[model samples]
Target chain A: MIISIVGAGALGKTYGGLLAQQHEVHYLMRSEYAQVKREGGFTLVFPPPQNSMQIEAPLLHQDAKTLPPSDLVIISTKTTANHELGALLGHCIKENTLVLVIQNGIGNEEWISQLVPHNPLICGVSSMKATRLENNTVEIAYIAELRLAPFQAATEKQCEIIEQAFAATSPAIPVKAYQSYKEIRWRKLIWNVPFSALSIIYQQDTQVLATRQPYVSIVRALMNEVADIAKADGVTISQEHMAKMLEATQKSGPYYPSMYFDSIQGKPIEKEYIIDNVLALARQYHIETPMLNLIQTNLN
Target chain B: MIISIVGAGALGKTYGGLLAQQHEVHYLMRSEYAQVKREGGFTLVFPPPQNSMQIEAPLLHQDAKTLPPSDLVIISTKTTANHELGALLGHCIKENTLVLVIQNGIGNEEWISQLVPHNPLICGVSSMKATRLENNTVEIAYIAELRLAPFQAATEKQCEIIEQAFAATSPAIPVKAYQSYKEIRWRKLIWNVPFSALSIIYQQDTQVLATRQPYVSIVRALMNEVADIAKADGVTISQEHMAKMLEATQKSGPYYPSMYFDSIQGKPIEKEYIIDNVLALARQYHIETPMLNLIQTNLN
Candidate 1:
């Protein structure tokens, strides 16, 4: 099966390179298409001892008039750049093209659903953290399970075809399907809402937040607020989930999150999808989220 | 008249040097006593072309046997060092000593009042911003009016003696006495609570806060919260006073508050007196001070 990844960033390159081991994968990057084609393919370096392999996937440029419709088209870009998605994917998406959006934060799927109204939309929340080492190399920080849920009325066969494309990287890149996209998004928010905002505000990473007393307490309060907002939105988040999120953060060690890295590099932050959405829901539910609002104030 | 200025940091040195122009003044500092005494005298530099003069006030060490009773004893130190005031001032404060505590933040007077119960206690909040240039010298950033109020039952004659001691330097260092110490402290808090907290949080100074929009809005909210807490404590802060405070902040230009500077230099912050007192009063009156509490969380 043919798979096309829209973004060419760390996440896009990591997953695209892994799937390229078995299937025909194509990377869609407008600026770097020529250089990538000239270099033959990019390199994917896993953990030590694992030989770095060349990813020979073909390159797709932005200027192409028409795109070959693939079995699955994965949208893996920063939410800030989502504005260009419609123009980029216009010719690439077919009627039955399984649109799998593996992006961070909330509300991106609803955006795509509006654009490709008839396509079977599969929304996946990935916990697999990755980083681009160079222009032609991508590194995987940790291998965690990816949670996939259908946006609207996606059929089982479409989910199967999407999961099959990732089967080669299974176990290490396992996928778990959920019935409701909203629940999965909220669950992912349990980690994103607190860690992302705090790591930026305090200038500390996951380990610092986990070990420090008041920071740890603040993390609990933010998570609880997110849970309350989610429950008000008809989604119930369990206490066990909260504990698991905190535990995972403690185990991640001292690691600066993507938001912290972006701030240090003076890049545009993805606060709208992460914090703005939670704050909007909080206002709608008449919920008091002082900690979250404080974070929002710092970001603003 | 003799005046012994305790805690010879910036605030201590500035007021001490000014008073030395008229009265026989002495500065009390534990670590810098030998150096200050060896230097013979330190210079006090006012803003611009004003000729900086040498201050020949004697320096007092921590191990000084018995302190010569001063007509006015001005305690100008960070609130954190108030704990050591008992040991330091034991031999210094006389029964009739005018204990004018020109300290920042709250709760210090309460502690000092408990320590030196018999001495007439005067609480003065100085808006004069100054910085220490060397071990003995200090630079007055702005020569503003200093508000002096009796803590308990300090007589008007006592206030007069304190003001008369500062009369020689009155043009550069004006003093205004108030009837209620509580009211003046709360008024000073209208400026301190927000600016100090925000400067530390956003790592920006007063000018940044005044010019910025949302930050300006947050400052108003915090000031309003403080005013509400003050009112609940039986002190009526006028709307005009609030307007004046905001206007003064806007005109003061860019300046880092003591708290921000302290945090940057890795010194102990006076948050307990500034924020904790406000939060305690807020909780006592069943008032909601979410923004202030949010600032408290970050400090913790």
Candidate 2:
């Protein structure tokens, strides 16, 4: 199976490197193209007990137009760059190719659906913690499940095929499929919207956000706001589920979310996908999200 | 009249310097004492058209216990230092002294009232923009009206005398006395709560908060919340007043509020008086202030 990973940042490189172990994986690169090509491939670093390996350079396409069409295209770009998706995906995917958006926040699937209307879109959120140490050097702190859901024309068979592809990797990247894409996305937001946003705002990590006093309360309020917005959008996220998410984050050991790193590096964040999208839905549903609204202001 | 400026910060120095031109003014000093004593005065820089002046060392006392009691004691300390007011004022004021609490935010008068129970407490908010340049130098950008209101047993006669003392200064510090302290505090909060708190958070000035989108809306939302809390607390802060406050702030030309500077200097902010007190009132009234609550979390 041929798989193409677009916008190969930290997550993109990690997932693409893993898939390259099992199948032919092509990385569409931009800034890191020269170094990655010079390095001959990505050096995948796994935590202790799990052996690390290097992926010898496969087909590294700097331009999307030069890349061959593949069975699956993973859109792991920071959703801030979703603007370039139409041109990138248009030049890379075939007529029934499955496009998996393993990105944070809401509106990615809708944006991709609009960008590449005919493709089968699979939207998923990865719990795996990965960081790009340098160009073509990907460090994996953990490999967790990639929860996937079919959006629009995505079928069960395609989902299963994608699941199997991940499962066959050197260290299996667990995959779970849900019936409702909205549920999974909002569930992810239950963590992402508050911790990701607040981590950047407070210049602190998940441990502080989850365990601190007023911050803990603010996180809860933000989660409640996200849940209310999700409910209004036809997705019900239970209080127990939100509590579990907070509990997991409290024990996540001062982890900085992708958005925090983006802010630290002075790069544009996925504020549009993660926060603005939720705000738009909240506005559409006439739900007042004052905390979310305040967070939105700070993002700018 | 003998005027004792309790906290000789930027505003304290400016006001004290102005009053020293006419009335006998004494400055109770702390951190700036040694430098001020060495210089033998405070250099007050007035905006052009008004010449800057040097206030030769009046009775600059480091120990409040050693200071002589005054007819009027102007409390211009950051509300964060309200803890020290009891000891400081206990040593510096006479039983019937007119204690003018020229500070920011709510609860200041209440706090001072408890501290020096028998004094005629005049609670006020100054619109003057003053910044401490050096140990004994204060640069005055603009000196606007000092809006005062009697807290508990402060008499109209005492308010008039205080107003006249300010009026008799070389360049008059205009003072307006309102009937209700709560009304004046809340009215001031329509500007202080949002601009002061957010300026610190964004590390930007009032101009950005006032002119920027989403932020402008946020400022409005915060103002509305403050007004709601004010209304619940029996103070009527009209929309027109809030709009005027925002408009004034927009034209204030990138001014950094005192809180912003305090944050930059790593000093504690007036979060308790400015935000937490309002939140407490909000909780008491059962009014939802999501923005204020979130701001409170960030202050910690």
Candidate 3:
């Protein structure tokens, strides 16, 4: 299957590199384009005893205008650049093309669906944690299943195909298909909103946020707020789910969320996508999310 | 009057230096003690256009036990070290000595009153901004009124004497004497709680907080919370007062609150006295202060 990965940053590179091993994967690059092209390809550094592999001379395209339409187009850019998606995906999205938005926060799938109205849209929430070390070097810190939910014209069969493609890779990337888009997004937010926001605010990692005294309480409060907002927005997030999210984060070792990295690197955060959207939903549902409001204020 | 300024930090040094010009002022030092003693005395650097003055060879003591019982004992330390006050002020605080706590936050005067029950205690909220360049060098950024309120056994006449002493200095630090301690502390918190807390959380100074978009809104929300908590605690803070606090902060140019400086310098912030105390009061009154709670959580 022909696949294209847009905004080839850490996550983009990691997933794109894996997919490139078995499928025709084309990388649409921006800042790292010249260096990646000069280096001929990129390297994927796996955690633990897993050997690092060089993804030699994968198909790289600087402009989406030049890239051909593929069966799948993975949008993995920082949501801060989601504005550029219209022009970036205009040329690559066909009627049957599966547009997978594997990014943090909510509202990206909706935004993408509006742009490519006829294309099948898929919302992806990845527990897979990765970071770009250098221009052409990407490191995978943790590998977990990427949860997929069909949005717009996307069918369950389309999600299955995408899962099978990932499963065909040398090191199979785990994929889980969920029925409800809102449920999966809200579930991901249960972890993302608190850990991502608090990590940046407190300048701590996920483990500290999950295990520390006031931080742990704060994390729970923030999660409860998210759950309340989610429920108001037609999704019921249980106490067990919140507990599981906290437990997973606690066992994930010390890991900095993407937003934390964005803040430290002086890059614009995914505040609008992750936080502002949640706040908007809270307002829409008339849900009182003081903790979430507080996060929004701090981020602003 | 023989006055002793404890915790000879920027505020301690600046006020102590000014008072030393007329009164027999002794500074009780800790980290800066050796260097201050070695240098003979500290230098007070005024804002531009004013000549810097060398406060030459002022009486300095390391151990409070060695110092004479003071007529007035000024506690200007970070409230994080307030625990050490029992030991630090034990020898210097006489039965009639006026113990003035010239520090940020709410609980310092209360704590000091508990420590030296018979001694006249004064709560001071200074708009004067200063920074210690070195062990023996303190710079005055903005000179404003020092608001004073009687905490325990403090007479109106005692406040006047303190005010008059400040007036006698070459560069007189303005002083305002208020009748109610709670009212004055809450009034100060209208500015301190928001600016100080937000300054640390957002990593921005007063001007940014006062002038910026969502930050300006946040500042107002936080101020409202403080006002609500104060009102519940029997102190009525007017809207005009909150506006005035914000306006003053906006006009103060760019100023980092003491708490902000403490945060950046890796010193323990005045969180206990400034925020936690306020939170405790809010809880006591059953006042909901989401913004304040948020600030407390971030600080933790």
Highest lDDT scorer: 3
Which is the better candidate, 1 or 2, if ranked by lDDT?
A: 2
Q: Write the per-residue lDDT of candidate 3 for residues B1-300, one digit (tens) a residue.
A: 999998888898899889987899988888888887888887999987777999888788888887689999999988899998899987887779988998878877878887898988888888777888854678887688999988889899999999999999878888999998888888888888888888888788899899875578778878888888899888998999778878877887887887888899898998898899998988898876645766777777
Candidate 3 Cα errors over 4 Å, as ranges: B1-300
lDDT of candidate 2 over B1-300, digit per residue (tens): 788889888888888888887888888889988888888887888888999888886678898887678888899988888998888886677879889998888888877888888888988888888888855678888878998888778888888998898888878888898898898888888888998888877677889889975467668778888888899999988888888888888887878888888889898888888898999999999887756756777677
Recovered fraction of real interface contacts per model: 0.12, 0.06, 0.12
Per-residue lDDT tens digits for candidate 2, residues A134-227, read: 5557888887889999997988878898889888887888899988899899988999999899898878889988997557877988898899
**Over the stretch A51-102, how does candidate 3's per-residue lDDT look in tens digits?**
8989898788888897788889999888999998889998777768888999
Model 1 CA deviation exceeding 4 Å by range: A1-121, A124-293, A296-300, B64-66, B170-172
Every model's DockQ: 0.08, 0.07, 0.08
Q: How do the predictions measure up, each by TM-score? A: 0.57, 0.59, 0.57
Give each prediction's root-mean-square deviation over alpha carbons.
14.9, 13.4, 14.4
* Model 1 clashing residue pairs (backbone): none
Over A1-300, each residue of candidate 1 has an lDDT whose tens digit, in order, gives 677788877788788878877777777876567767788777777765566667774555545244667778889878877887888787778778888998778888878888889888998888877877656777776667778888865876676666666776622467788888888899888888888888887787888887675578668878888998999988899999889778877887888888888888898888988999889989989986656767787776
Candidate 1 lDDT score at position B22: 71
